[model samples]
Target: MSERVVPEDSRQRRRPTKQGAVLSEGLIVETALRLIAQHGADALSVRRLGAALGADPTALYRYFRNTDALLLAVADEMIGRAQEGWTPTGDWRTDLRAMGLRIHACYQSNPRAAALAAHRTTGRPHEKRAVERILGILRSAGFPDALAVRIYHAFVDQALAFAAQDAAALALPAAAQEKEAEVWNAVYGKLSADTHPHIAATFPLLAADMRESGYPFALELMLGAVAALRPERRNS
Candidate 1:
């Protein structure tokens, strides 16, 4: 019989050797992000993530101590992705608007991941960078340091709060969404025309607002308010 030999790399691949471990911290974080995007934060667990990665569950602990660490890493990754390719335009309103829209779009793109990351303060590098960028925008707009800080706080809180709410809404099953819509429609649709004339008159508009207008509109409104608050430009 002819001698048979297996290629070393092939053997390593088949036997799950740590010699060339395919899984790393970055890969783990990326996988976790995907899981969060696909199955919501509630569905993500070490076992589930390991299964998805085709690696031993304990293998993940080599990179992340626990699910919370993994979640923080995911948050960092989300914020990092949001800031990618962003540049300071020097125009305060334009820059702030761009930053807000980028963050909003990022959350809207991965509602599940956003749901996990939006509210938690990881204080990661990417988040710090985002904060600096926003503060810079306010400063460029001629707001004092205190006012700029306050505006940044409000902007971040509102963005994340709305992102969390939107993610929760999006995570609902279609049937549940329909049911909730129906309940709201029925309850609000039944308001007496005599007693709640305004409600009855604008029911359609209200419902449309509930469905059509979302975080982006709210974000713009917030930015507009901030701009209005900016000290008027002095032409020296």
Candidate 2:
């Protein structure tokens, strides 16, 4: 028979870390997020996490089975924070816009963690609640089950894809970020009109629009499509 593992809470009660600080799963996740924010996602290792927490690296295993498990917890925390104060307005479109923006803002604010976990499915409490909320919004808006699920997939994935893309940009080193930021002026902005007439014609507009994250614009388009597919519209 395999050895039975002890529960995390029981373990936590038994011993504090070497620095005399108590280690809870919440504290560990918080420290990991801080480490990622300061040093980038690549800096997240059990050893580094332990050092930051003043704990034995082995002690971390008592709470999380592995780094992946801790990552899921951290990912779930992102969802939790995003959903913390959110309430659906009576209007489904407005609620969705609010939710999509809230999640994007949360991810943008913690780009290092977002870059690492944006595509993750945590199967944790916060993720479960978010899934429920989105489905609830669609269903309550009169979408049939199949259609609602389909739209949910597109909406959530689009938000995450945009978040990850934006986060990757945010996560770049300072020098790389500056080079990318200068591309509009240094490369596209200087293209000969004869060679790239269309781009030249729109260069002023493109320059202003391209500087921001595309999530909000993409989100509006998505919401418009979803509105078109609403059950009432289809039935009419």
TM-scores of all models? 0.83, 0.92
Where does model 1 exceed 4 Å of error?
1-21, 233-236
- Candidate 1: worst 10 consecutive residues by lDDT? 10-19
Model 1 agreement with the true structure over 1-236: per-residue lDDT tens digits = 11234343332223342334477667778878777777776545877777877887656656555678678888888888888899988887778777877787778788888877887778878888888888887876789899899999998888778767877777788899898788658898889899999999999888878884377778888878887787777311
Model 1 Cα RMSD, 1 decimal: 8.1
lDDT of 2 by residue, 202-231 (tens): 999998998899899899999989888887
Give the lDDT of residue 17 in candidate 1.
Answer: 26
- Which candidate ranks first by lDDT, i.e. highest? 2
Clashing pairs in 1: none
lDDT of each: 0.76, 0.87
